[model samples]
Target: MKLLLKNTRTLTENGEFEACDVLIVENMVQTISSFIEIEDVDRIIDCQERLLVPGFIDVHIHLREPGGEHKETIKTGTKAAARGGFTTVCAMPNTNPVPDKLETVQQLLERIKNDALVRVLPYAAITKGLKGEELTNIDQLSKLDIFGFTDDGVGIQAADAMYRAMQLAAQNGKAIVAHCEDNSIVYGGVVHDGAVSKRLDLPGIPSLSESVQIARDVLLAEATGCHYHVCHVSTKESVRVIRDAKKAGIKVTAEVTPHHLLLSEDAIEQDDANFKMNPPLRSKEDQDALLEGLLEGTIDFIATDHAPHSSDEKAQGMLHAPFGIVGLETAFPLLYTYLVKQNKITLKQLVDWLTIKPASIFGLPYGKLAANVVADLTLIDVEREMNIDKHTFYSKGKNTPFHNWNVTGVPVLTICDGEIVYEEDFHV
Candidate 1:
């Protein structure tokens, strides 16, 4: 099929343009020129004044399928990813039946191939059943075309286990993504263990719960010679740790969720469990540090950590509720509206964080609009303004704290592997 997208601002690695025509043939970009004279084009998307970008990629998302289909399945989660302008997403294997075995990873691949709206790359669990005890079959699992390995909902508390896992993963040429939480220090607490938790008389989850583990992993990774990635870094101390690790020349990378970068524990005072998440949002100082890290390029990319739990699960009070918020559907609009428009970050930097940076970190063949690259693209109607509406969400979960928040940009069309997976104006 031949697709022509014209009158759009194409976002290149260098910068943005006023207008260009993106020509696609099948699953590759045939040409991106000022004008194209082509015959027998199957479709033409008039992206006048809109921003055409390489479809965003999320390296951290929990599909919760092959287990918690009630919360989110491959179909629902990937639809959410597509609607959020993501052409590719990596699913962390902390599912009911952990995807540590090669057979489990293969099953997930099949499920995603049949059900997902966008590409879903599975991340096998670093340990079988994610028990953090025995290591998963890295040799076999790595051969299945998976991306990275992570016992993601929890840090492999055993240093020996983690070191061994990283060594094996490094030898296999795979990266080790760590949850970076010291569950031992977390002590089963709920919110950030500070003013908000004290005032509400709730159990507190301390900042060190994350930072301590990040510190430990950095050292271990240095010794193991593996590419270590810190997931959803939320504290100032964690930022310093990652920064120092990078300085020390460790093969390290880290990501910050939009919630942690934009929101703080102050929002928790409003009594909404939706604000709740694992490594719960921290203090204003922590938020500032996270933003500083992003501005200075210390943080590698922005991942939604797009954890989706059902309303029923989230409805369970703050203390007993599941820890996460639905982010994939709202990430772009929120970031573009807040960070880009405010000039805290440039559009090019923002796109790179969402696209190229992530691809680089995970070593995927995505995040570029150049010729012969996979034709995964996201067309954004930058001029469009809208409010966050859970009703329009494609995922089964609607536990986002940003409900009703005003957002200016939205994805108008999403194309994956040359297929028009999602389009706002579907009928036309």
Candidate 2:
């Protein structure tokens, strides 16, 4: 079968746009040119000069399946990823009945195989049941097609445990992704330990809670020669430590979430639960450092940290609500509107952070648009504008703070392995 995507445009070397047509045969991109006329094409999509690029990849997302189906499932979550321009997403291992055992891992694999709309690479939990007490059988679990080992919802509280996990993961050639937070330092904080917390009369999660852990793990990573990745870095100090580690030649990479990049504690404005998140929105200074880190290559890439929760849970106000927000449906458009259009960064830089940068760091053979490559692609209509509506999202969780925000650079169509996975307002 032949599929033709015509009148679309590709981003040029100079960050300009160039018109092109992409032809796919089976699951591989056959050719990309200014124009191609072919007979017996099974399908032709008029991209209408929309931007065509390698599908975006988010290495940090919570699919919340195998147990947390009330929040999100594989089918709904992957559809949300596709709609947000992500053709590939890495699922965090923080579900109920976490993927520490091989049997449980197999259950998730089967779910992905049967229900995923796009590519879903899952990670094995680092500790048994994510209790942070006993380490999982990393040697045995690494033999599977898992991306790495992580107990993402909560940080491993014990230094000895993390060091040992890193050693085991390094021996097996797996990355050790971490959620860096010190529960001791956090002290039941809900918002950031900043003016927002002080004025609101609520407990605050200090930067030390996030940064101290990063400092510790980077050292462990260096000693073990492991690829240590920091998830949802939200502090200037966290960026400083990661920056220092990279300078010292430690095998380290870090990701900054769109929420952290776009909003700070100052943006909270009120005691709202939707604005609540782990590694909570920090001071504007910390937010600035995060952008600088991304620009200077200190921060490896962009991830949404797309945690979804029920509306009822989120309605419990700032202190009682779960710490997360739905991100898959609004990430690209939000970033583009806030960062790219504002001229804080170029559009090419944004695309790279979302695609090639993360893929390169993770050693995934994706995030490129080239001949004879798998046809994992997204067509984005940059000129189109729409207000983000939570009710319209494919994700079950409508817990985003960016509701009703106007934005562009939205993904209109997504293809995975030469098959149409998601197309806006159309049946795939």
Candidate 3:
């Protein structure tokens, strides 16, 4: 069936907004012009001058399927992702039976084939069971349809092990997505080591724990000439190191979460676990540096790291709770309201960060709205203001700190592969 979305404002190839109509035939964008002639179209959606952009892609998200379904499953998590205007999400390898072996990767693929609503790409584990001792079968796993290699919940502590992994990835034409943390330096701290930790008398996680490892990985990346991607970068010094590495022509790219760009440790007024996360929120100076890095293109893109834990687990207060919070449901609204509205970055820049940047980095082919491309699109109401309510979330994990925060920019319709996967009924 053919679908025509009419009277929408779209970002052009030159980063300017223009009025246009897009026509999707089957699973490809058939036409995109000011006036698409309606001929035998099965459906016509009046976009009402809303913003139409490429479907957002989140490269780092934990679906927690095959093992930890109590927190979130592929079905529920992909629904949440579609509601947030994401059409594709890369699933982390930290599942029950890690995707280290070919059988494990096939197991994940079978689950995605049966349960996924949006496109789900799984990452194979770098180490066997993510223990950081033995390497996984990267050569065989890369032959499958996996995205890359990562041991997301834990970092690769051994430098020689990481170098071997990078060499393997380089030979197989794949990336090594790293969760850079030297466990020896972490010292059992929960939150960022700063004034907030000092005031609350809580154990603090120092900035060195993140930057020091990043410094190590970039040198390894430069040595191996492999595509090394840093996940959820949260410190100012990390940004500086990444910037210098890029200048020196290292094949290194990094991403920053919205929480790191918007909120600081000062936002942790109480001992709530929702404010707690791995690579915990840093000081205001760190936040400013992250924002600057994003604007200057030092930071490659934005990923939610959308990890969801059970309510019972998060109710244990800040110190006892696990490190993570749900972000697939609120990432776009929060960033659009806070960053774009404040004039820190233009809407086009924000769209590129969420859409094209990550797609380009991961070598995916589904981030543009041009003719002959795959018809993955999202229509957003940028003027709509609503308070975030966790109860209304499609995700099982309602663990979020932005509840009741009034924000503009809601996704009204999401289309993946020319199919209407999600639609918000404004009239109702």
Model 2 lDDT, residue 243, Cα:
95
- Cα lDDT of model 2 by residue, 1-428, tens digit: 79999899999879999999999999999999999999889999888888999999999999999799999999999999988888999999888789999999999999999999999999999999999999999999999989999999799999999999999999999999999998999899999988999999999998998899999999999999999999999999999999999999999999999999999999888889999999799999999999999999999899999999999999999989999999988988999999999999998999999988988888888889989888999899888888999999999999998998999878889998888888885322
Q: Which pairs clash (backbone N, Cα, C closer than 3 Å) in model 1?
A: none
lDDT of 1 by residue, 146-179 (tens): 8889998888889999999989999999999989
Better of 1 and 2 by TM-score: 2
Q: Is candidate 1 or candidate 3 better by TM-score?
A: 3
lDDT of each structure?
0.88, 0.93, 0.93
Pick the winner on lDDT between candidates 1 and 3: 3
By summed lDDT, which 10 consecutive residues of candidate 1 come out lowest? 11-20
Answer with 1 or 2, whichever has the higher lDDT: 2
Off by over 4 Å in 2: 425-428
TM-score per model over all chains: 0.98, 0.98, 0.99
Model 2 scores a C-alpha lDDT of: 0.93
TM accuracy, model 2: 0.98
